[model samples]
Target: MTVLLTGCSQGHSPFIPMLGAYFPYWMLCTFIGLLGAFCLRVLLIYWGIDDKLPVPLLFYFAIMLSISLTISLLYFTY
Candidate 1:
């Protein structure tokens, strides 16, 4: 049982220190991803494509998730 739990502590924590506080790396990625999604939404609205999506909310949410995962993979390792 102890051996099985040992793997849990093997990797470095992805916390970052900022202004005397520790923030999870995923938080940053998600925030950036959200901003990207919002910007994309604005552009899509401007271009008249936002109304064409069958499921706009879910599509934007997926885009946000993809952006977050991509940023995490490119910059951090688990």
Candidate 2:
């Protein structure tokens, strides 16, 4: 028996062409999310509020994902 898998064809590329290279949109969104998370962490630390969180690591991860998804939707969606 042989099986063939077909992927969705949306007739549009999922990458952003920059300069001479193509970059994945998700990766760019992820990077932006990470940068935003880092800046938030710094601000929280400076304000002496970082330690107040019950679960810092989970909170940070959630924040990054939320930011990433928001960016992707805003930029990629019609």
Candidate 3:
């Protein structure tokens, strides 16, 4: 995703430079999204959303994955 994001821009453009400058910011967003999904899973389990684990994680990951895709799309379009 990083490579795609970076490669989508022309080498000498100001926008490309700014995108490169904030590469870590994108990484941070990815990490935060995954972490948020994990924490939400634990909270849901504590609240008895399910009597077992694993499957609920599928849902969590799906949600987070969609969010990550959205962020990437926004970055791409911007």
Candidate 4:
């Protein structure tokens, strides 16, 4: 029973090989998320709705989190 519990976790953490170093998976997701947020912001501005947001900073932050979390969940489930 102890072994079963202990061995449930995978041997390796999620990592991506970049050149010679292993980059944490979440960083890549974060960069992608930031890009997504920026694109959304551009679209909002183009639509003339960016200034109408009640709290633009929080809204953008939430957008970033949603993008990153979706990537992490869909591709790297443990």
The alpha-carbon root-mean-square deviation between model 4 and the true structure, to one decimal in Å, is: 3.1
Give the runs in model 1 whose Cα sits over 4 Å from its true position: 1-11
Model 3 pairs in collision: none
Ranking by lDDT: 4, 1, 2, 3
| lDDT by residue for model 1 (1-78), tens | 887776446366678787899798899999989999999999999999999999999999999999999999998775
Candidate 3: tens digits of C-alpha lDDT, residues 12-66: 2323234446453456557767877888777877999766665775888887887
Candidate 2 lands at a TM-score of 0.83
Question: Going through the candidates in order, what is the number of backbone clashes in each?
Answer: 0, 0, 0, 0
Between prediction 2 and prediction 4, which has the larger lDDT? 4
lDDT of each: 0.90, 0.86, 0.65, 0.91
Q: Which scores better on TM-score, 3 or 4?
A: 4
Q: Write the per-residue lDDT of candidate 2 for residues 1-78, one digit (tens) a residue.
A: 122322223445687887899897899999999999999999999999999999999999999999999999999864
lDDT of 4 by residue, 1-78 (tens): 776676335565578788899898999999999999999999999999999999999999999999999999998776
* Candidate number with the higher TM-score (2 or 3): 2
Better of 2 and 4 by TM-score: 2
Task: Give the Cα error of residue 13 in candidate 3, in Å.
Answer: 8.0
Off by over 4 Å in 2: 1-11
TM-score, cand. 1: 0.83
TM-score of each: 0.83, 0.83, 0.50, 0.82
